[model samples]
Target chain A: MTWEIFNAIGTIAFAISGAIVALEEEYDILGVYVLGMVTAFGGGAIRNLLIGVPVSALWDQGLLFLMAILVITVVFLFPLRALKQWKRWGTFTDAIGLSTFAILGALYAAEMNHPLSATIIAALLTGSGGGMLRDVLAGRKPVVLREDIYGLWAMLAGLLIGVGAVNQTWGLYVLFVAIVILRMMTVHYKWRLPHRTIKQQEDVSV
Target chain B: MTWEIFNAIGTIAFAISGAIVALEEEYDILGVYVLGMVTAFGGGAIRNLLIGVPVSALWDQGLLFLMAILVITVVFLFPLRALKQWKRWGTFTDAIGLSTFAILGALYAAEMNHPLSATIIAALLTGSGGGMLRDVLAGRKPVVLREDIYGLWAMLAGLLIGVGAVNQTWGLYVLFVAIVILRMMTVHYKWRLPHRTIKQQEDVSV
Candidate 1:
């Protein structure tokens, strides 16, 4: 996917997830829009902060605020049509968002000339940090800290981008394709690191 | 007051308020620190956002985070000493914070060349918005929106700063003195806006 296309997908996917979480929390109209915008844009802000970028929320405030309100209004009116019903859609969007954030973060880190490890770390953070914060805000355990197929997807994308930086020619599509496929397959089967007998019993308790 | 001194007062005042709110809510240690920092710095962040200033939170993250943790630690260690047992002090610090934030917000806006009304609005928001959010997070009625001397002091400071800007010789101290004195006296005297009287209340209810 082109950077712009994938970026759009990332924003919408994150917004949908945020809406779902807000709905589960029983937020009001304003609260739903706020969570949606916050979950979509919050990771970017944190990434910019880490890279010491200047403030950029200086968008035409009217336009963005209007857009956020509009999205909420439409969702309220037609909640079913506002989001897809297919299970695969969720998996697809999640994968797309993960890859998009990871690459964006890696590129930003490179622009900041961080070391490889730092770049990888930042990329992974940018990729999954929003979901982590969203879960925390929604009063659920952070998906990143759970014993499942997570963080590693972002890590893989970051590693790909970090190594590809040496060659400096892998198009954005290449990274997106690799990350989406790997992530979907892992999450599809609930693939995760092994747990010992004690850990298994603890999981049952939880 | 110098920026340093005003900032210090804001830091300690807001931190104390946050901790008290957190304790009242029975938050965990980590939750307490996080709430404390947000309560302290959230207003300034909103102020910077409205005026396109680089938020102090971006540059002062380390110091702010460290101060939050330290304040929480101190509060935990010496509850009596840390939280000065002055019911009047509660009224006092809260008022001072409101006034100072208003002044600070106005100054930043004037620097950004926003219109006078917008400047005043931003000032009012900066003074009370963070506290409002803090109260919401803690599940209490916002003091600013209730029957109190809270938002009035902010308005008073805004008026002083707005008039000073007309003269074009307003320094930090001039604004500081006007804000602090008005707020302090308002609290000491228990000044408040007129509220619903018995007849008026009955009429409204009917």
Candidate 2:
């Protein structure tokens, strides 16, 4: 029951986020739905493919698909002026969705007896893969790769799971909350991942 | 034997193409290899995921991976002045890879008894999907989506296979050559798919 609830929340949040990006990019209605569905399911699909899950298994989540579609439609229909108020909420919900999906991915990989590295990879992909796809489709730089410590939170969740530190139901819940809080803190503090330009290196050599 | 040969052609050509793009974007050596690998295998991986092929099957082709890596390394080490001469050939080789992969994708889907729509989709994805992934990772618009009639040839190949119009070995070769020629002609003539900007539509409405 908890799993289903968390999944639903993540799906709805991702769908809304995708819809917002599509709107910002001025995509057509079809593009809006396409992006929304991709954002909600693309990460899981990518993870499943990598972890040897049957791709057809994706089709079984009919309810989640419907929920995502409904959420995206509502977001699309909401007044533009009113939608501006939800911008801050979008970040909060996105953080929740990211942490939830990351933990779930780690748990799933662990249950499959995958190695620790695979578990961590699964978590990172499931947590940020959808956003990467969205940014790619929208022709923007992937924020997760270039911005704050977003993927680190997912890796942390994966490490916690792989080490058997968050096995119990209460423990999983606690981990979820902790990840969300940490992600939000990074955002609040404007944390950034270190990056260096090749151009700078070339200039130094010259 | 023929199938393996075509796969090699596609993989090598794609790797070089990807490496060139990475160099153009001034990525580090690691980025070049990552992009090269993604461009070579991304389309096939995506097609496998969508068509119920076990994605782990991708790892079995150790030789192909090695070949791609070698090709990328060679391209990376080549003289930059000499590399400029191959720009025209890049288009030719890319066309070959695109057509070869598209036909192969269509045949795979048809052999699996997928519907014509799925076969066409598979072909399109397999042909252009890698390039799309490359462009997205490079933080640029996907040329496949924005320019030319690139995907049409893939769809046509899928349609031919799905309809059993090109079942013989000789017929498949003929179809492949025809697709390459058609794609080349489209490029030579600068043919473009029809597109409309939302800004133009909004301007008209106002």
Candidate 3:
């Protein structure tokens, strides 16, 4: 309902998704915890620094955040086998985290009175950067770099928030609806970019 | 040598050593280059931030520094096997970088008119911090946390610099000489603290 609430939810979503992926990679506990914590907090820290907050936000409520990451890592360690095996859910929850975070990052940019282009770019970056980093460190090609709908969902959510801001009608609820609707549609239709189906015009040289 | 000269030498020394250690960990060329970059420049970056200097010391000359790292990494990668087997030389080089950095850090604190104890501590930290971070990221136990002479040599170097400062007999050259002398002696004798060492004690307690 509130921004703080959504941020917490997004953090948990990312942490869980990170833990699931780490398990699939057969990482040790330290790797799982590291990946999970980074996934949960890295984007926020990057955003905060760009917005002139140098220290990590985790220090504000350090123990709670650590517990969130730890719990998810522990879950993926043993009892969360079903979640780890559910490839589609892993892909889908990752999308949810990505799209929602895009909205949150754009909100921070608009709050800072950044111009539309920079605001949108920051939103897009924050939403996707953590997952990209996590995948790289985990030694896998990132899903967004594939033909997945992952990044497109987040960028669309960011675009929606930017449009709302342009019309001077932006509100928190607008962001919430945008993320959920985009994520749901993406999941429902298995939607991705029209990259594969784009018109193939011959070059002028031809 | 002026402090600036010693500092420049120390930075390059650390970078070269860092590149070698990174190769020992079997990193790819890009990773090895970045590791060397961190080893060389990380100390001064921290010191700059602490003393309120701008951060461009990292960002502005970043490409040149990166080139240094790349050159060193490429040069070291081939000869690394022979080099690693030179246990004595390896330790000596590591000690040299450590001691040089420590003395430089202490000199900086003295320049800032920091209190004696704080100055000593800062110097020791600067000397060892870069390598400690490098080792940890490379998945090695930090060398300073060993029961060996690693951190002690740096402190000894710092202490010598501090004494020179106290008696007004200090010059940058004097401090540099002290660091090199103490570091060489420590390496020659395997001059670790005995079984009652702090590292041993910490390990026991933990």
Q: Judged by lDDT, which candidate is best?
A: 2
Candidate that beats the other on TM-score, 1 or 3, i.e. the better one: 1
lDDT, candidate 2, at B10 = 87
lDDT of each: 0.64, 0.81, 0.61
Q: In model 1, which residue pairs have backbone atoms overlapping below 3 Å?
A: none
Best by DockQ: 2
In the order shown, the candidates' DockQ scores are 0.06, 0.12, 0.06
Model 2 Cα lDDT, one tens digit per residue, A1-206:
77788777877877887777766666655456656777887788777777878764665666787788788888778876666656567778889889988987898899999999999999999998888887788787777888778999999999999989889899989999999999888878978778788755645863
User: Which runs in model 1 stand beyond 4 Å of their true positions?
Assistant: A55-69, A80-88, A165-170, A195-206, B1-17, B25-38, B45-206
The TM-score obtained by model 2 is 0.60
How do the residues B38-68 of candidate 1 rate in per-residue lDDT, one tens digit apiece? 7788888877765667675546657655775
Chain A, candidate 2, TM-score of 0.94
Q: Which is superior by DockQ, 2 or 3?
A: 2
The interface RMSD values of the models, given in order, are 14.9, 8.0, 14.7
Relative to the true structure, candidate 3 reaches a TM of 0.57
* Every model: Cα RMSD to truth: 10.4, 7.4, 11.1
RMSD of candidate 3 to the true fold? 11.1
Off by over 4 Å in 3: A55-58, A165-171, A196-206, B1-18, B21-35, B42-54, B57-81, B84-206
Q: Candidate 2 docking: what grade?
A: incorrect
TM for chain B in all models? Answer: 0.82, 0.94, 0.78
Writing each residue's lDDT as its tens digit, candidate 2 over B1-206 gives 66788888988888888998999999999999999999999988877877788767899999999999999999899998978987787888889889988988888888887777667767877888888789888987666655678877888998899889899889988998999999899889987654322221211100
